[model samples]
Target: MFQSIPWLESNSELWLQISIVGLGLGAIVLFAETLHRLTGNSSELARKVVHIGTGNVILVAWWLQIPAWVGISASIIASLIALLSYYIPILPGINSVGRKSLGTFFYAISIGVLVAWFWPLQQFHYAAVGILVMAWGDGLAGLIGQKFGQHPYEVWGMKKSWEGSLTMALVSYAVSCLILLSVQGNVWQTWLVPVAIAIVATALESVSKLGIDNLTVPLGSAALGYYLSQLLPLGS
Candidate 1:
C-alpha cells in the first residue's frame, strides 16, 4: 500500500528545500543545547529555545511553498527520532530538559497531524496560530512565571500562577490575531474568533499535566479556531 515519493526526483528543488529546512531546524535545536552545555548555562533556557525554534520552523514550510506531505513527513520522522532519543540520548536538546515527559514528541506529532489533515484544506492558518501560541505564548509564560511569579496557584495539581496563565492568554491572543489577520485580512470583525480561541487554548494549557499541554494547546486551538471560523465569518 505504498506509492512513489513525489518529492524525491522530479521535484529536486522541493527535496532540497525540505532538506535545508529540516537540517536547519535540527541544527538550531542541537546548537542551542550544545551552547548551553559548553557555557554551563541553565538547561531550562535551552529547552525553551528549542521549543520556540521548532514551532517557528513550521512556518518555513509555508514560506518555501513546500508540499504539505513533505512537511508532515518531516514532523513525524523528527518526532519519532525524538521519542527514541528519550532512551538513546542521541539529541541532547531533546532530552536535556529535566522534566520527565514525552511532551516533545507530542508536540511534534500534534503539528505533523495538523499539517497532514487540516492544512491542505485552507485552514493552515489555524494550525499556525495554535502552534505559535504554544511556542511563543506557552514558552514565554514559563519563562516569565519562573522569573517573577509572585501570585501562585495550582490547576489540577499543576503548579502555575496568575502571572503565567495571564501571559499565556494575552500572548496567545496577540499571536493568534496577528497570524490570522495576516492570512485572512485586517477585518475588525475577525477579532472575536481569535480571542475565543486564545482563551480556550490558554485554559487547556493551564490544566495539562505531564506535558499533555503539548498536544492539547495546539490541537485545541486549531479545533476551536476552525469551528468558530465557521460560525463567525472572518471576511470583510
Candidate 2:
C-alpha cells in the first residue's frame, strides 16, 4: 500500500504549515536585526534571537501535528534560504553575528537531525534542553564575555574568558534544571542529571571550533541527557 510512503498522500498542508512558520521566523530575524542596528546592541543579541527562535520554532511542528519529516524538511528549507542570504547580502544582520562559518547551516541541520533521532525514543526533551542551553548558555556567554571579560584564556587558541565559560556552565545548569523539572517533575534524583549534562555541554562548547559549537553543544548535550535520563529515575 502507498500508505507507507510518507509523501504519497497530499502534503500540501504540511508544506503550508511550515511555510507560515518560516515566514514568521524570517520576519522575526529582520525585525530584530533592525532593532539591533538602531540600538547599537551587540550583534550577539540578535544572534541569540535567531538561535533561540530556531530552537523554539519547532513548537509549530508540534502544534500543527505535522509528521517528523515535515519538520525536518522545513528546517532544511529554512537553512537553505539563510545560506543563500550569505551570498546575496540579505539578512545581513544575522550574517554579521559570526565570523566566516556555516554555523547557520549547522544550526538548521542540528534541529532536524536531533528531532528525528530523538522523536522515536520519546526523548525529545533532551533535544529541547540541548538547544535551549546552546541558545541561552552560549548566546549569553558571548554577550556577557564581550562586555565583562577580564581574565581571558585560550581554548584551541580561540581566546575565551573565564567569565564566559562560567556563565555557560551556570546558565546551562539552570536551563537544564527547569526543563527536566517541568517534564519529569520535581524529584530529588532529577537535580543530579542536569549537573552532569551542564558539565559535558560546557566542555564540548569550549573545544568546538569554527562556530561548530552551535551544533556540538546541543547534540552533545542531548546525547548525554538522553543517556542520563535512561539511567536515572527521571520520573516518579
Candidate 2: C-alpha RMSD after superposition: 4.8
Predicted model with the maximum lDDT: 1
Best by TM-score: 1
TM-score of model number 2: 0.84
Indicate the residue-level lDDT of 93 in model 1: 47
| Residue-pair clashes per candidate | 0, 0
lDDT of 1 by residue, 1-236 (tens): 98887666688897689788979786888788787878876767787888888888767776776788887788889788778877786656447434577778889888888787676786677778878889988999989899989999989889998898889999999988888778878776457777887789878888778788999999898888887777777553
Candidate 1 TM-score, C-alpha based: 0.90
- Give stretches of model 1 more than 4 Å off: 1-9, 96-99
